[model samples]
Target: MNGVENNLDIKTYDIPTDSDPVHDNPIISNILLSRGIVDRKQADLGLASLSHYDTLPDIKKAVKIISLAIEHNKNILIIGDYDADGATSTSVAVMGLQRLGAKNVRWLIPARLTMGYGLNNNLLEQIYQKKPNLIITVDNGISATETCQTLSEEGIEVIITDHHLPPETLPNATAIVNPKLAENEFALSNLSGVGVMFYVLIALRAYLSEQKILTQKINLADLLSLVAIGTLADLVPMDKNNRILVHNGLLKIKNQQCPMGVLQICQIANINPADINSVDIGFKIAPNINAAGRIHQMDVAVECLISSNYETCNKKAHELKKLNNQRKITSSKMKDEAESQLIGIKKILNSHHDLFGICLYDESWHEGIIGIIAGKICEQMNLPVIIFTNSYDDNILRGSARSTHKINLKNMLDNFYQIHKDKILKYGGHAMAAGLSIKKDFLTEFSLLFNQECGKLLKNKSLKKEILTDGQLNPVNRNPIFVRNLQEVMPWGMGLAEPVFYDDFIVLSYKILQNKFTKMFIKDKNGSSTWNVIYFGGVIDTKKGDEITIVYKLSINNFYNKPDVQLIVQNYTLK
Candidate 1:
């Protein structure tokens, strides 16, 4: 274990003051001020959140495409992604159209390890087996020019709805509804894949309503809860538009009338539905849905989500729990082996570069766990990371890239693809994260090329990771009132982050409990500040009597029927 502890001057932050006139409430004001929300209306908007139903752009175009598909009685196959957003988007598109009296709609999600991501000609062939009249791709297909071209050549109409960054050349589909297609045009460019699909559904619903083909039995607002889950889970930028969708979704979850699957997930996570937020989705809901896709079939998750039957939903929830547990164990084992292999890379140990970027591949490693491992390493090492693994039966090498503030992983992947087009089989992603598949034998070549690329682009100053804090606060204010207010404003994820507070504390006592967690009792000068810090898996390098600066989120800990406030430590350093 490596432990570094020393007393150092605490770094101060430019904490927003009450006089800043940004917000009237101290808690909301502090939170908004941290994110540059200086105006009262902006704060209110952020807190209230928006909806896809309220802000569906290009409604006329979207509705026209759906109505054409319906009138033609085309076989519409909803092509989805393997993650939560994709699953929810697929569900929404299929159900929404089916509700609109379209009986021929079907759904398909490419196997992550086999066909890979996006709507491709090969995937179209798979869908063609069903002999559908039309194909609607959700959460993907923006970059699928060749696939869409093939569909068009075969006299198949394609409607693409996606939120991923589009390539320089757009696909010539029957109709395309991508918010990021052009800058400064769409107000909700930050929507998730599911959110985009939801917009299409909203337009379709409106057209059906006008035609008197459907009843008002199902309100689009009812589906916002799913949209919220997908949006928050996908980690889309929580800008104004996304915040509204998520905020309203939380309101539904809090009301406990969501699909049985969501309620079951909430119960399994022990999160109060009425109090759910973005963290709960990220830490609780999304992980389980993703685990199914990573380790098994995503269809299990999708089925669970769409099932209204309580027994089936409960069973699906339990299965997700079991798979998530297996995923946790698999990730830990793989990370250990990965680190063991990295020990020989002297450059990493010497700290020659301040930022640690990793790319490791083993045909023996399970492909499903690589992305989880990449994210875990990024969090643990505070650096951008890319984890590669090979398929046991195929020559294809696949990888998932995650990033920190220092470097943009998506841009890195994009640039690499541009230069090594011949070597890259496929690659596309958003700004902070991405996925790629390449020839297995080219692993060494890609790593060396990526290293050279980083050397040319990254500066030494960009190596160190920095933590942003809202500000310091008196320990006395860490009471129920403050915690409750924070909870009310929660469902925080991605762009709109959960607030983290920093303060100096003297370690009164410390111990490694359960051989995993590091528990510390700490207080500030004059004993005015006191708190208990629990760091999960923090036992590796910690000791008693250490003065430290800690960054943490406030959470209520209920164990053994005792209720108390707990600090979920994000990072810490010697004071």
Candidate 2:
């Protein structure tokens, strides 16, 4: 591929000359077609209905079991995880059940620092105190086989609604509702934990309507706003099904039909709900909700989602904001320390040219922020990274792993477990991210073995970083209308990425903002027109009158209530 070298030693690939779809503006069509949206039919499919919800394995059974619980008025407790997905799933379950006329519904979430993950014996002891007649696990419980048995033995029927990969032996719950257990179709399998619970609620609503047990009309669309937030926050792949769900959910949020809590969160984040998009949810809103789980307790996030009182929701939103700010400071410190240690490790391994993975451990690192640190390091170095810190139990070190291109973190961990089963106590996650724990004494050995396996797996894979560009934007195409067309596409995330284009420009002037952000103005090669650009977390060392090549995404900046087109720089090469 033709490439341009950037100051960071990264290469930018030249835009491809692929066939494009027919649209009013060829620029938009080219961008869409480059992402595999070949025709109008495919574009329409992005907003298609989620018709495969009923085909999910065991969904009907789960609905039947939940309907019976509601009809019998049995006390039901929803067990949720501490992440955003878990918090939203808990809110969806509790609120949806109450709407279905269930009077004794309650919820519980495990504290990461104290209770750890999943429904274990310790959590079961706490659940026993509640003495509920039935238990519904959302976003978690797939791995809690013994916990399921304990609940069953206690005469509490268990309904498991999760999306995590199940183990060899399944839990003997009353009904297991998980998309991973269904056929491998994207629509059937890529549902997040909250997405799964939303489907269960859909089936339950239909069953209630069919059985003539409905006291009042319940529209499931009202809950799509929550599903959208949870789905975006979880970082799941945005397949057609997910895109549809998010598209519909965005409509609710844009129309101000979302819960008061969601509105409050948007307000605290300084994002106008009516103009929000997937990026806002992923960056601004999701972080605050996740912060409640990471720094404090997820109960604050759940309460923020389920509370109807505006004042209470606003108070919780502010609390989450505070926690998020604190989390940022902690994460920044951990990242600096990790980077420093990484430099030392590189010095030690200078003789090892085939190193493919990195493992770092420090008792001082906060367990709650290791994941974020690992992700940032992995992105910066383009290597698989596993960071460990002491768990509540000093004998074991809990770690979070993040992967780069062509590396499957889950598979790598599984292979490591196969060879050194005793070293790794437990591991679980998807291809790009995972979590595990190991004996503190085996850290050195485990690190060596992990790098060896990763090196073997990535021997032939390219490690060079490449910035892909859609194409050069024509002078006439750089306008607010183009930005509006981009927003019309609705949802964009994991699978369907936002568009980035590359072009050469003359640097007119630039100013530093907050010592971290760069605000600049650039003109076309002929200096006919200029565009405003903002680069976050990036520094430009070049001066005015210098020519440069930049890859950027089209964006809209609303200042003083007037929207103007702007470029958000991704990478740049000075000439």
Candidate 3:
């Protein structure tokens, strides 16, 4: 079962924008305004308008230390996590440091299946062997309090650039540039791992330029493509500041001025560079990049992004494609198993015990992929979910959580940690998602407590998921040209969502794709015009000549060079 609620509601947004309508089409203007676009200034997503480096906490100190490392020719090793954000952050750090003349720079990313998440003992042992004079961490190290202390004892100075929520006791690093730090500006709040690294690189570049220490000048905008991919992949908020970063990055990527690896991945994913958007990265490129970390080691993915060789990126992209295929197969198997378990768990819900939080565990599951499964299940249940699998160690279990709007997951986890501090090995994440490790023996008790805590917070909240839409589409604005124009003002994601419109239609004909997705020929009931619609989930159970209403977004069909506009379904109702 798809688990999508057919009882959808259409809520037209009337939130006003500060300025006049920007787009020629009124529907487009209304859609933009609903997202609370303030003025033309926000619409102009140029690099000059990017937040200054000085705004980040410890920027000056971080730059000074990195500068000294470059000037003194000290060996510097970049420690990175094992996700897309981590891989891209490492790429930016390595490439930026090398460009700034740090000759002895190298990177060591943790292996997901073996080394666990961040700066654990396994990673620390490897770092110690490297014997680097300086260390820089990206996408991680915010919660590595004890690990950072160990590195300090080893006489290695660390500069941390991360964006995760910081722990109560911060890591003992020379400088921490996490935007989530209390001292940072609000503009930095939505910065992803790569975004933080980009700010650091810019700050270091500025310092070098001020000191007249650099002979060759380079524009850092070339790196925004990586920043965009990583930021979107991490699913960070798309606030105005983040929009500027992503918008500029898309410009560079579409213009073919980005790293060869990005273009190569796009080509392999069958994405046309001339017409790429945030959706392409979300659906096509990011998954392949993430697959390297989930199915294999991320070092190769990092190598692909940092390497300038055409043949190297080509080979790496193909390898990532293969990994992505494996990831899909494994993910499908896990998802099926999780769903089967959910069916059994629903019996408890039917017994009048409301399920506020869900905990699913399987020893045979792949730990690297639990987060994705948790997210999907959370969506299906409209509640908080934590999916756990057996860790590399025999006695431990690793869990990844995804939460609904009803509960603040980080706060709930913090409270749980406070009560059971000795039970959790490591736990840190944001409001929407988190990861943790614990003894496999505590699974039953932890699941009960988790459900209880979530029940407290979500007692008054409904478990049903809402499908919010941007009203109905005007017939005049439902053409290929207007849809193409809508694609221009993009980088839509969390905080700022893509527009969905609802309309009544007659299902003229329908065919099931792979017995899952439905491709239908729909005709506007108010007019004589007909259009193509692709319902993404399993079959909508509609047949020929059925009168129905469809909720959808206008999307471009990239079947060939000349793309056509089609409706991508979000929801539907039969009359």
Candidate 4:
């Protein structure tokens, strides 16, 4: 069911009047300039070096602490979150430390079902049992002020490397390395948790080399594949620095220079590592790895990342794939339930227009899959959504929030907290996504307040689904060579979105594929070319001879050794 009506609008970019090196094709030039790329130099910024690592806040301090720990042969335990970014960061820290000749390096990931997130008091007890002299947290711990203080008071040094936005009161850790802490805007926006950890390792390597402490040679570049996967999967904006990291990592994957586990994951996903792109990592590899953290235990994913044996990695990859399949099944059922609940809520509220946000709860819903369900509901409804389920604690309900780009979810939650301070137990996250917990008793009030806040925040804002298009496709440039060249230039994610163009087409014929996808032949209204288009996940309502305005991205469908030009339909409207 559609929650909010959407208005379709095509955007046009201003032509650059400066003497810039433009693309040979005007379509490509417009796409690049629309994304704020003015010239070839700006486009080439993805080739920037990792030297910017030195500029990150507290990098040197983190390196010093890690080096001292390694030299002293102290037991170092890494605390990581359960998501893919945390998994990759854990793997990078464990492997990087071992390669640097650290005698003992172990990692602990909080089970999403049990210990909850970050370095909580409960998780601290688990870490205390390990008797670690130092604690290195990756991908989390930025908000654990009390936990950090407790660890410090216990004489355990802590290094926090996280990418999440920090709170007002900083944790008293030995060193905190986060790009968001950078003074400049450029450094503050891009790096993911894995990127932060990678920088720490880079600084550590440099420090070790300068001190002549390195016993064996280690190439940090070998870990770029993991970095790439984590960065893409984390959904961070693909700024220049992030692009450079992803580009290099994709190259490593293409050259078969990544870890055995990564290669095995690619194999299990039916992807050729040599031909994989950022999209493959996000849609295929990341989800499989993330499934372990969500449905089972994160250690399975961490083990898969750190394993050096191809057989062992392949085995773990299979396990992860199974978990992912289970996760999908669970998420699908939850989505159906949530949609039904939403319809009920709409009736109760009396008007669909009143629903600026949706809050749903189900005791039977799997808490691990609620976030995915929330995201799916948010996308389908075109409204901010929060899905709640039973938490480990009987008295508390855990919820995950997903919102449109216009809404700052974390900030919204913060505003709610200001009014209903006693209701929300705890919450954290970024602009588009967040997680929270509240007393079960307050769920009703909290839900009402949440909806009201969303209404007040989004007053007068249209809830229409906006399909941003790069003007219209030039029929002359719609060919295999043009699409191939576009794909070769760069990877796309977050801020650097994949180019989507819209144009009128005459539907020639259509056939249902596998009862799920729709395969159609459509001729451009502007040209005589007949293009094959595939619409996945859903089918269009139009039939043969229907003229429709279609939004799609140019794609190459490689079957066997032959590559054919195909349009992957994003959205369409009857003309």
Go through the candidates in order and give each one's C-alpha lDDT.
Answer: 0.74, 0.84, 0.86, 0.84
lDDT of 4: 0.84
lDDT of 3 by residue, 156-273 (tens): 9999999887878998899999888856458778899999999999999989999999867967788999999999888898988899999989999989999899899998899888
lDDT of 1 by residue, 5-109 (tens): 222223434545654766446756767766656666555544234444434445567677678778777677888888889888887787678777677888888
Question: Per-residue CA lDDT of candidate 4, range 443-499, in tens?
Answer: 888888778888987888766678777878777678778887777566688888888
Candidate 2 ranges with C-alpha deviation above 4 Å: 1-23, 45-48, 349-355, 512-515, 525-528
Instruction: Arrange candidates by TM-score, descending.
Output: 3, 4, 2, 1
Which 10 consecutive residues of model 3 have the lowest summed lDDT?
A: 1-10
- Which pairs clash inside model 1? 7-575, 8-575, 49-244, 50-244, 75-133, 75-134, 254-274, 277-491, 278-491
Candidate order by lDDT, highest to lowest?
A: 3, 4, 2, 1
- Residues 344-384 of candidate 2 have per-residue lDDT tens digits of 87777766566689999999888888999988888767789
In candidate 2, list every pair of residues with a backbone clash: none
TM-score winner, 2 or 3: 3
Q: Highest lDDT, which number?
A: 3
For candidate 2, what's the RMSD?
3.2
Measured against the true structure, the TM-scores of the candidates, in listed sequence, are: 0.89, 0.92, 0.94, 0.93
Q: Clashing residue pairs in candidate 3, if any?
A: none
